[model samples]
Target: MYSNTSELAEDKLLLLYLLDKIKLPISNNKVTEIILENNFINYFTLQQYLTELANANFINYIEQEGKHRIIVSNKGLKVLSLFRNRISEVKIKAIDCYLKKQMESIKKEIAISADYTIEGNNYIVNLKAVENNSILIDLKLNVASNKQAKDLCAKWKKNSSKLYNELFKVLINN
Candidate 1:
């Protein structure tokens, strides 16, 4: 939606600013959701900006499990510090407000995950707990039925922390 060169630069700076503010590796989907939800930029434009930023080393992509997560680089932080004011104050405040409201949900989304796939005659369930871009636990199990796999995945998402604690306790105490 931006038609001017300055506007283009501003948009790119905005993206960098947002990524720097997040301070955590975030999924592409969540980044898209945040930018689109705020009507900051169009989807295609956002994608283009992201690619440019990555290409310029302003952002870095990490492949965790099967998902690509984005984080701001040190170079990006320096750039943001130098040109952050290119983004309007209104937009900056808006981004901060949105993050304040959504941070908890965002952290939750990044912390625990579960998925299942069929393999031969059984189902393979993968459960994980992640913190600060590190894997706290990666547990895989084989279940006999689709229903069981689904149930386990759902439970893992909801109770991974408790389950992990109990598992650690048992393993260490035994």
Candidate 2:
């Protein structure tokens, strides 16, 4: 879990690139070709990005015969989204003093298996890990809302997910 970041990054690039492409689970060469044709990023740098995404347990784009493919499983979307929101919020630091105790309390009540500390430019947080088999149910008290986070989680599924996911699925199914 701690080392899947690189591969997860790669997956993101592949997914993002192939999102509206000929669908995923295509040929291995197709993935490489897509990477090359994009040319927005070079080989080594791109590889590193892929590696990062993979390490984070995102998804992997593999090539088989002559097509590219994708594998989507989990939802780190909530955690990742939270990271995005709190990323620039300096006030998050104020919760530090109570964070440790809160973490302990949460661990007792929930199935958080492991945790990681992410240090941001303005804030830091200890992300309590949820079980690999469980869906993350986040319940917060209060905060000014953008609703994007709520919307993101709702879009986790194809039918219930957002237009991007539905469109992505159509392309993949073909």
Kindly report the root-mean-square deviation of model 2 from the true structure over all alpha carbons. Answer: 21.5
Tell me how far candidate 1 lies from the true structure as C-alpha RMSD in angstroms.
2.2
- Model 1 score (lDDT): 0.90
Candidate 2, 96-156: lDDT as tens digits: 3333334444323233222122233222212222333354432222212335334433333
**Alpha-carbon lDDT, every model:** 0.90, 0.39
**In terms of TM-score, which candidate is strongest?**
1
Best candidate per lDDT, number? 1
> In model 2, what lDDT does residue 26 have?
36
**Model 1: residues >4 Å from true position, as ranges?**
1-3, 162-174
lDDT of 1 at 78: 91
- Model 1, position 100: C-alpha lDDT score: 97
